[model samples]
Target: MELSQAEIEDLLSRAAKGQIVRTDFLDPAAASFTRDLLRNYPEVNYKVDGGYPSAERVRFAFFPIYVFPEDVELNIGFIEITGNFKFQTVTHRDFLGAIVGTGIKRDKVGDLILIPNGCQVVVDRDLVPYLIQQLDKVHRVSVKVKEIVREELLLPEAKTREIVAFVKSLRLDSVGASGFGISRSQMVKEIEGQKVRVNWKLQVKPSYEVAPGDVISLRGRGRVEVVEIAGVSKSGRNKVILRRYL
Candidate 1:
């Protein structure tokens, strides 16, 4: 991820002045970048907050060494969208499209978890009222949007498909194409076009090596996790086990 000069500098300036600094929702790349960059300033302390475990989007709260990390407020909110499913069912794209249509920037929103009979939406707390009033329908389906506590969140089980494949090298393109079930040529195009991400950071290099536990995701497609790398096969190809999120 390309680090923005103003973004990091502004946060650092606040911390240097002993002022509590909080950022808006940040993508995984920005979060990772800030998490690493702040380490240079040992006087400042920070907390990575995404409202839930394994959240991709998160905010960082920076304060002085004297301040309690838990005292910093992330101001995250959880909202649920439920609708009559017999007539029409909604998808992630549909939910996102409807939310984006409400004139809210994508950065203000976070992850949308799919659940039975509805979906759980994590977002900036200040935007809750606006969203609840403005967002009422997705495509042709009528939805009910309401605020919910963290414990009330009905988390759904993640779906995955395992792939066991062999390749000469564990290059991004080779593993990505195999996991995404696409051709190497097509994967290259997507990578160069900035449609691919490794661990939620933009990765344009197809030759980038991927180790076990690295996540490879393609825009419009689900994510893939490199689960294992056993010894090379008899044919000399590298053996791999990948779990592709469905």
Candidate 2:
């Protein structure tokens, strides 16, 4: 992947401020051009995707480069992400599913990006600089996207008692409001009926651990994403923050 001196300098200047910015160009072809100009900078981070899903793929590569050290005190880092304009409605799931599975269906390189995990939906040739940016010790350039199938969703199974469990911890009704998008009573009833899953496994206990990668599917309601495990409450219960998608 190659970037122009101006684009490279722009990314470096922003990285100095600890801001993660996806390049505004939004062109995959620009990534190749940018990669050619990035050879002089060693402190910057970058990735490229070569083996994409389609032929009309804009001849673009997905590039995500992070400029934060692992041992840094802050949790955030600067990321310069670039991609070509493809289609919309492309969710983060589409990106991760492509990288970890049999690749995205039919659609060619849509330049998708999945957050939380920060995995890039990329083509085959653009994988080099990306690996260089993420790995610290070695400079192995050849890496392939391997597939691992999960017959069923796993982790982050929702339970009927989770509303009460979160309520018990924070003494707040927001969990009921934010999670189920319904009344607390409705949440209690739904959970008790064994309608949730934590990490793709059916979770019956309301107090089950809502770890990352868990998807909670409510029959009437929509899915909720357990984005992260923030921290423990003063009451000693697990504090799992979730984002429900309606």
Candidate 3:
């Protein structure tokens, strides 16, 4: 994660001012960068949330260390889109395009939660009105939109496939490919193409070693986490347990 020096300095300066600064929703890479940068300022307190549990992308808030408010709230809202639709037909990309088409910056938007009847979009509270007024359609389908309380939001249960594999070593590409059912040659190609990420940072080296608790994400293939390296197999191979998100 290559961040500009100016950006880090600006964030530090804002933290020093004792002001509550909220950043737009950041990708995993950017979020990691911000977390690393905040380490330099011990007096700055921060929190990261994405309006729901286990969200991949999230927003970060920086506050003064002395101000520890009990009920610090997030500036977020949910937009529920209702229409005649079928399950799995409307995707996150469709809803995102409609919102971005309304001139709302991508950073202002948070997670897009797809439900049985409709989809819920999390966004900056300030953009709720505009989104409600301007987001009229998604992919040419007329839709009705309404704001829902945070408590009313519904998240789908994550589906995962657990597998135990025997590998010669714990190299990232080798384990990831085995877990996700991709060929080693293809995994190397993907890594070289910059489509592989380890713990949110892009990893271009296929030979990069992985350990237990490491989260690996392959573009277009979903994510997986190393649950455990149980032990060595009788054939001198490593036994690894992986949970692949579906």
Candidate 4:
């Protein structure tokens, strides 16, 4: 679902008066809706940020047109959680459930990046202290959390592997199967089940044509991107190169 209309309207109203209004973290669909809403108010200056680069969840800040985005302060913080990983393993779900269990809205939290020692949580700077104090145990493993500066946040690099596919057409089912190393029949099932997203928007039609630079994602599966189309081959088939994210 998109952000609440009343909440957005309130932020816009206050932002029109030169006050900087900020929203909690939002997913892609919600961020898209907010971006569309802001287009109608050209007088409001806005910035979207997720504390670090390539953050999946981000927040929006709105201010008067006279104020520059850099002038607005963004209160985002990181917390490093260390525990006995050798004896017990902690996953994203475990850390997420533990933090959510502490009564904070999931929107208040951003990404939780796994590191060698443990996972680093991105959250609103104001909640750093509370999270460090309340978050003690994760997945039955005792843990310790400490506030870390923005510079210390460990963001992983995106790794992708190139895959080659020959299909009759650049249809979603054909190319997606090759990109994700799944069978065409399985790809069709995924699309029909509302588990496939093209560029983050759901695409149910298996026949949808995908172009270079388009990103296709299957829920629970990593993303696949069309890197290049090598044109028609001598066998009357199209050669495509896909980048599968790991």
Candidate 5:
């Protein structure tokens, strides 16, 4: 859902009043918007965590401008859904559809890790019970759900393909198009359509310079990280190393 400036101000106002306001699961675009909004209100502190390592989408919690206790944990829960792995393998989209079908907002859900035998989903704590009760099927396959401890959560292993390419410039579009094997015009089109993200924030400008260590995500194309700038090529082009998530 699109949030207006007034709604953002109201959320900040509540946080300033010492109220702990937690938001639903926010996609990269919404999360970036919230981050930009929070920049104007330093008095209202907040945190964004997706409950696992390397989570792209996340939930935001607004806290008063005060030192937090050491024991304060993020309000995240894991739901382990197991099904007949031999008969049907549940994919990330399948689990996501089942969760969303239960009337849960997209922002309330986090990463969905597909395991060999089942899948694990990170979600807001408030919706744990509801998800467990409602997430009984994934597509046409029957599934079982139960809450698991944070330690029990299984994270997906990263599988990336290293790409070494030379581009005219280190701009997002230049490196992304060359690394992903797309035309420059196609990359620009994707950027203009708001289907490209740099470091998890929506970046519309194709000319935005991308630095080493920056991760670029294109909708429908997976993600790619600029690993390093090896050096300048003989022709004065940039020699860059990229790791594309597979």
Candidate 6:
């Protein structure tokens, strides 16, 4: 629901249990809607999420809004999403990027970004109908209500080098294939063409198995799967290390 800062504050104050998820996205009418909600309802458990778009995923890439009852746990969920709306983190960099991409110039004030991951929302079940009504008039945001499950960490105790090295050892063509959906050859070409770097240094080899303490940087695919070679290979053809980007 759109809400003014004052109205939001008032609503929050009146809520016996309250939560708000801010995004970097903004609608001119959002603040006013928020104010209206506060004026009408003293207790509002509003859960909002938002984020920027990524080439990696399409659905939750747009500015998205969602709500669940306040009893739900706020945990980071990692799932392949498919829908009309996408999400990303709301940061100064994200805001400027949106402005540049959309060619929409507006000031950033109390704007929040709803990352596709790393965020959640909670609201009272009874308030959903009213929330949906307010969202109908708010532009640039599409709201969906879903049961979310948080992502389970694979190696919580593993270090960066361990992660990268483990991925490299996956015997995939490239780090992209292992961590991302891209192929190994594609990753190699990007690096060999001076598009890839290890610890920020130009790297051209796709088969260059990552080790612990190495930071592999790809131009378009993003950086990953290189760390210091923390351990040696048993057959001498493989090694183990942690990835800087897990």
Best by lDDT: 4
Worst window of 10 by summed lDDT in candidate 2: 71-80
Q: How many residue pairs in model 2 have overlapping backbones?
A: 37
TM-scores for every candidate against the unseen true structure: 0.76, 0.28, 0.87, 0.84, 0.82, 0.29
TM-score of 3: 0.87
In angstroms, the error of model 6 at 65 is 52
Residue-by-residue lDDT tens digits, candidate 4, 34-62: 87788878889888888787888888889
Task: Please say which candidate is ahead in TM-score: 2 or 5.
Answer: 5
The C-alpha lDDT values of all candidates are: 0.86, 0.42, 0.83, 0.88, 0.83, 0.39
Compose the digit string of candidate 6's lDDT tens values, residues 1-246. 333467455445545344343323335244324534545543444443322221111111111123345544322222211123435224335433432333333322222224443223222223334333333211233334343332321212423323433343533245435444466676655656777665445556666655444445666655565434445455553444434443
- Candidate 3 structure quality by residue, lDDT tens digits, 1-246: 223546655866786797777777887778777887888888888888888877767877778888775545568777898777764377889888888899988888888888876689889988888888888888777888898988888888889999999999899878988988988889999999999999888999999999998889999999999999999988999999999999
Misplaced by over 4 Å in model 1 are 1-5, 93-105, 129-143, 164-166, 182-194, 228-239
For candidate 6, the C-alpha RMSD (Å) to the true structure equals 15.9
> How would you encode candidate 1's per-residue C-alpha lDDT over 1-246 as one tens digit per residue?
333747776887788789998777787778767866787888898877777887778877788889998788888898998888776767888988899899988877788888877789888899899999999888878889999978886666678999998988999999999999999999999999999998778999999999998999899997999999987999999999999999
Question: Which candidate leads the pack in TM-score?
Answer: 3
Please write out the lDDT profile of model 5 over residues 1-246, one tens digit for every residue. Answer: 645557767888898888877776676667777888898888888777887757767877787878483334568888888888787656788888888898987767888888877888888888889878888888778889999987887776789899999989998889999778899999999999999989778899999999987889999999999999999988999999999998
Q: Which rank order by TM-score, best down to worst?
A: 3, 4, 5, 1, 6, 2
> Compared to the true structure, candidate 5 yields what TM-score?
0.82
User: Which residue pairs in model 1 clash with each other?
Assistant: none
lDDT of 6 at 5: 62
TM-score of 4: 0.84
User: 1-246, model 2: which lDDT tens digit per residue?
Assistant: 234558656775564455443343224345444655556445455443232322112332222345433322211112212233233334555443433343323223334433332334333323434433443211111223222122211223334323222434422222433566677566556667876544334555554544564556666676666565667778876566766654
lDDT for predicted candidate 4 compared with the true structure: 0.88
* Sequence-dependent TM-score of model 1: 0.76
